[model samples]
Target: MIRCDAHMHTRFSEDSDASVHSMLDAAIERGMEAVCITDHLDKDFPQTPDFPAGAFLFDLGNYFQRLTQLKEEYQKKLEVRIGVEIGLQPHLGEYYKELTEKYPFDFVIGSVHLIHGQDPYYRGFFEGRSDEEAYHEAFEVTIENLKKINSFDSLGHLDYVVRYGTHQAEEYSYRKYADEIDEILKHLISHGKGLEMNMAGMKYGLGFPNPHPDVIRRYRELGGEIVTIGADAHRPEHVAFDFDKAGEILISCGFSYYAEFKGRKPIFKRIVP
Candidate 1:
């Protein structure tokens, strides 16, 4: 299969379990054509920048060093790409901008993992906030963050609230939030930002694909041409999970092809199963 999983995470990310070698090995074993290692970098993880969440121990120097060595080591076996997942908070834009300026990433994902300073990975975040409030904040924060940092390529998991919210996918379809969704798609389209097809929704049993296929179609309807499918895999087992389904969603979303990056520029290819 000719496939690329652009959003896999490694142990460098706070919640991930796979290592760079482990993820790449899984991709090679699965016969994937390419893969990107996009570990998380949120400055608020304590003492870094505007984030007080404590410093994350993600070592970029080592990451690049090892990636360079591994790319050379595995070039004939598999193509490994360098990427980073930056958590977007309005307060941390400048830091991220400066950081990316110094690092040449093949892919950069802008995701909203926290709302109002709390991560939804924890349970209580879905408790105190109403479903509407939670969903609204998620969308608003994503839009606000994207607006602030227009430099990134793809907008990650636009419907991520469903993964951790009080509501399920059946209750959280495109019709319920069309206006805001349109605004987001239009903004991204205007800025030429691609959307990410994160298959983690299916992996987590969220019923629909991440961002919901309907929303993806709407994005295409609003002139969105570029997209990147990511399993958002934190473990080897999750790598390229549901990739066929992601491609199907893209085709139905009016996209004839999907994109992968090298040297921070897009190279589009038709979705092949």
Candidate 2:
């Protein structure tokens, strides 16, 4: 079983109302060995008139203060790691670089949640574009960000666009974007960065991980080794969702080990049959 949940959000994340203490209690109840509080930190966020500005940005001082208190409080029962999930954009690459450098984070998950100043979460982004066009454009932007930045530890939810695509993920497959996907994987491998096996797809009813099983297999075949398991949980109950199934998926993809990070270094743990 994957013992550590490396991606989670708390009250610090604008999208979530869960507190750090409540989440820690839930992780303990589920028998988790470790949990990382990776709250959202999306800089230069394109705020809509309705969305307002700096909504996703969290106070670093308050975040660390709460983290330090919780780490000390739960140090005996569960291990807590300080982490951040950075929303990558072409123009904010340098901003994230300085952010990561300024903080002492255990892990960083780089994710692309927007394209052309719009998010796929809303239907309007996919209104005129074909699902194929939308998905491909998202991947293209991912490649652009990956090339421009090298500060994050792993790429979060590689095929994130498919989760919210108008037609859903039924029409998506790795074969359709093999070249672009390969380029992304090659960039990660070259930089010694990792990939995250995000289980949020199950919650979204996609019946697979963010990148799909074939994409994970291809990542392994391309000599990519570092992989972390996370439910991408924003609430207490969502932590470590379908982790056993995630292990099965990893083993089927020829990954005998999943990764855990401390001080920004990956330590692989063997997957048992």
Candidate 3:
């Protein structure tokens, strides 16, 4: 089993109400070896009716203080790693670099939650364009952001746009976007970055994880080795959700290990057969 759930959010993130203690308790109950609290840090996030200005931002001072205390309290039971999930935009490269360096984060997850200054989560993003076009645009923007951001351990939920796409995964497949996806995989591999296998795709009823099993296989075939398992959970119950299936998917995808991070470096652990 993939014992370390490398991605999760707590009350530190504006979107979640689950406390850090609640999440850690859930991880312990599930018998996980480690969990990373990668709260959101999307600078200059576009404001919407439901999300206002600074909605994706958090107070780093308070976050670090509370987590530092909890990390030690739980050290004997479960490993708690400090992390942040940064929303990648071309303009925020240097900003994120400075923020990452200023803090002592154990891991960082770089994700593209917006495309062209608009969030794909809303139905409006898919309007005036075909689903295929919108999906392609997301991948294109992801490539652009990847080129700009360099202070991340793994790319989170590589096909995140698909979760909100109209018709969702019905019109999505790695083969459909091989040219762009291949370039993305190659870029990550060449940069010593890792891909995240997020289980939240299943929670969203996609029937498969983000990037799909085919993408994972293709990543391996391209000589990419580092992959991390994450539930992308915002609630206690969702912590490590569908992790068993995650292990099966990793094994089937030709991965013998999953990655965990400490002090911004990867530590691979074997997946027992």
Candidate 4:
């Protein structure tokens, strides 16, 4: 089996505490074959009460230098890919593409963590926005960003807004949202991109799997072949959280293969059912 944590963060990311070395050490102990240090790269919304006003943004200069050194040091032990998890915001479109072009990252995971300029990490990001509006904005922002930045390798968590929305899956399944979701999935497939199976939802008490398994199956049905599974793990214990479940979900979704990345290209491995 291939053991990889494609969505890991280090101290370079505002939300994480572990250093790259410490994370690599822990992954090594657990026999991880590959891991990517995907720190957040959100330029706007840099003001967090805990971290200073300018603290939430990524400083590409030092981040690239440090990741370059670590990749060399760990090359003998495991394949290390340098990456970033960019927050897909509409206004910052050009800036993100410029950053990617300037950096030497091997993989890029674009995400929609903020809706209408506020984050779910804060208490009132959704106070004024209706749940429908929030969900709609989430989809709109994702499509807008994808259209602007085709440099990314994959899209993160298709239905992540459900995690914080007022409405749960009580009425809509991923299947029910097929018209919209299929449009997104087809876009990914057409552009030679993929979606990530973010297992973090389960750990966060979202009550369902990430991207919802039903969506995973639909992606398969729509010729969406590439998928990279991640815990979105911020700490050691969560490195492979629900990965077994992730594999099972893929199998049930009719996926005979799962993927890993190196040098910005996906490498698929057959899933033994």
Candidate 5:
């Protein structure tokens, strides 16, 4: 019944301040069966003048230690899966492959948070580009990354750019980038990878899940079955946010099951009414 929130950030992620214990408490309080700690691991993240190089990157040694402790501490109350959200850039495919191969993570979410070394979250990314151009570029880059990388279990937040788009995803839809989106889905299906139903869009004021229901429907139509639901929460309160609505969206998209991962393999759970 979609009991697992598979994508969440903790203090290990530079942008997140939520502690591992706090996130676990929140998930348990919400009656969650499991919550995976998918901290960010953006290799070769572009450096900003204000910060030191690789600020978004975490110390893998410390992260694994914390994860081991958390799993032991929360074993009885909730399931804690070790996961990572690797920022997928065009040039870092081999690096990520080596990193994931070295780590024993339960799942890996390959995300395109950066486009052409610029994060779409800031206004400057859309300063001169048309909404169409921005969105299309994001999709095109994602398709390229997917074609090149075979390391992640699911693609995180397919329409992540929309949250920060100048138009606020007001007119974004599957029709606008259907060809590109379809190609991305086809690659995922062919590689046994999945898509993530990221609920962060609602919190980010997009009023919909990332990739929207139309996109999810198209993925299902293209024989894509594995879809993981995540709050994309960076804080305790945001964990599992808008999940009920997410489930409704999946049901509407004709998805009878949602996926959860273990040892990088998908475990589908039926959606119960």
Candidate 6:
């Protein structure tokens, strides 16, 4: 079983209302070994009706202060690690590098949440293009951002755009974008970065995890070994959502172990059968 949920959020994330204490308690109740509080740090997030200017930003001082105390408070019953999920944009590479260096993070997830200054969560991002065009552009931009940044431990959700697509994975596949997708996988592998198998795909009703089972298998086939499991949970109940299936998926993909992080380095834990 995958007991370590490497990605989660709380009120500090700006998008979540769940407090840090509630989230840790829920993880302990479920017998989780470790949970990383990877709140959002999406600089320059575009303002929207639901998400106004700086909606995804948070105060780092308060975040670490609270989490540091809780990390000690929960040390006996559970392991709470400090982490951050950074939204990657090509121009923000240096800014993220400095931010990451200044903080004592146990893990960092580099993700692509915006494409061309527009979030795909909004309909405006897809208004003038076919789903294929939109998806292609997202991947292209992901490649650009990945090429520019190297401060994160894992890439958050390789196919995050599919979650907001018109059909939402009905027409998505690794084979469809094999060339671009392979480039992404190869880059991560060559750089020693990991890929996150975000279970939020199932939570979002995509019928599969982000990047799909095929992509996970392909990553292994190409000699990529680091894969982190996460629920991307924003609330207490969502912690480790669908994680039982996470081990099964990793096993089927030829991964005998999943990754956990401490001090920004990956530790491989065996997946018990």
Highest lDDT scorer: 3
Winner of 1 and 4 under TM-score: 1
> What TM-score, computed on C-alpha atoms, does each candidate reach?
0.94, 0.97, 0.98, 0.91, 0.97, 0.98
Per-model tally of clashing residue pairs? 6, 0, 0, 0, 0, 0
Error of 3 at 9 (Å): 0.5
Residue 60 miss distance in model 4 (angstroms) = 2.3
lDDT of 1: 0.82
Q: What tens digits encode model 4's per-residue C-alpha lDDT throughout 1-273?
A: 438878888888888988788888877876678888888877776565566665557678888788888889999997788888888877877787788888878789988877767676665766887766666677777777777777678888888888877665544576556667777888999999978988888886875567888888888988989998777777777776766666777888988898877778998988764
Shift of residue 183 alpha carbon in model 2, Å: 0.6
Question: What is the lDDT ranking, best to worst?
Answer: 3, 6, 2, 5, 1, 4
Query: Clashing residue pairs, candidate 4?
Result: none
Error of 2 at 229 (Å): 0.9
Which digits, one per residue and each the tens of the lDDT, describe model 6 over residues 170-211? 678899988989999999999999999999999888978897
List model 1 lDDT by residue over 92-144, tens digit each.
Answer: 87888888888889999888877877777667777877777778778888778
Model 2 alpha-carbon drift over 4 Å, by segment = 48-50
Q: Write the per-residue lDDT of candidate 2 for residues 35-127, one digit (tens) a residue.
A: 988999988676764467666898888888889898999999999999999998888878888888888999999999889778888888999
What is the lDDT, from 0 to 100, of the residue 156 in candidate 2? 95
> Global lDDT of each model?
0.82, 0.89, 0.93, 0.79, 0.89, 0.92
Candidate 3 residue-wise lDDT, 12-109, digit = tens: 88889999999999999988989999999999888876798667998998999999999999999999999999999999999999999999999999
